[model samples]
Target: MPNSTTDTYLIGDMKNGKPFNGFFIYPRTNIWLIFDFYLNGKRLFQVYNDLLTASMVEDTETSFTAISNKNIFVNDRLKSGIEVTPVRVKKGIVDIARNVNNFRTTGFILTLFDNRSPEYIEIRPIAHGYELISTDKNTIEVTYHASGKKLVFRDLEGRVLTKSKRFNSDHYSITLEKLAYTLKYRLVDAESLERFVKEQW
Candidate 1:
């Protein structure tokens, strides 16, 4: 399999007999399918929360064959299809995370696709020594503070998932039906903050 570098694949026709064409990330246990498109010369990616059940159809040294049983949502309706023989199979997020060299010391944002809804979650990192804000809106903000070196996962309406005084990466592995995430971070020199933003944002 290839690395996390963006690759192209074919999304077959829908089960309802509708023709479809798109690109997606390689199938993995947990991954995002970002459809790329151009509008007025501006590139954009449409992220979808999709589940795949893949079975090998053929195998070759250069490329392999597989069919994916895809479950996705379109137009507020659940759609399913069996994609036969995708063009290529590349690596995904989970694969990149397994390779430690990809780790960034500075904080970063993780964009997640919610399986149950069209809404997605944006996990943002707050700088140290800042006052956390509170809002009663539907959008939630999960904050990590340096005071007690604790990480607080909560919704804007005030629902807590895991709050630990001690920083632990495993705390985020727990599945919360409304909001689920896997947090990973590394401590870096405070001076590198600017560079981090440029690289991530």
Candidate 2:
């Protein structure tokens, strides 16, 4: 019920060496992307809006089609995409999440760059319809950019956390076709990144 996990966000090098990551940013209503999850036992529905709404199901390999009615957005802003990690609790139930929540979302986005060397950032739009171009290979160009900050983290015998180099509020953007990277990147849903980071702890 969503666009994709961080798994399929690669292009041009699926069968070769370690594939390159293309951080394709989904089209934003304002400045955010929303992902909705619905879990029915082993099957979980991940839905997102990319101009028009799109979705996918995860946790099973059964070849089938998933169809369900969902309200993608409540207002005109992006909703928080938090994944419930407790096995006893359903990950996608909003009401249950409210009652059983414990994780603090203060530095959530900072945790997304855990081990993935996130490289390029691509902002694309739908022209006529969805082009379904790999991830960052845009059929119709909307806007493509990325900005890397000096990041720091300790991966020792203990725990490792995503740390930002900047402590203050600062936003920067870099636009390019291909940029030289000491580290590459990944294109993913904001919520998937959130869930992935949350599970690690």
RMSD per prediction, one decimal? 16.0, 20.6
The local distance difference test score of model 2 is 0.25
User: Per-residue alpha-carbon lDDT of model 2 for 36-71, expressed as tens digits?
Assistant: 332221113223332211212242432122223222
Off by over 4 Å in 1: 1-120, 129-148, 153-156, 159-173, 176-184, 187-201
lDDT of 1 by residue, 11-73 (tens): 432334432334434343234343432222322333332222111222343222232223333
How high is each candidate's TM-score? 0.23, 0.18
Q: In every candidate, how many clashes are there?
A: 0, 12
RMSD of 2: 20.6
Looking at model 1, report the run of 10 residues with the lowest lDDT sum: 92-101
- The 0-to-1 C-alpha lDDT of every candidate, in the order given, reads 0.29, 0.25
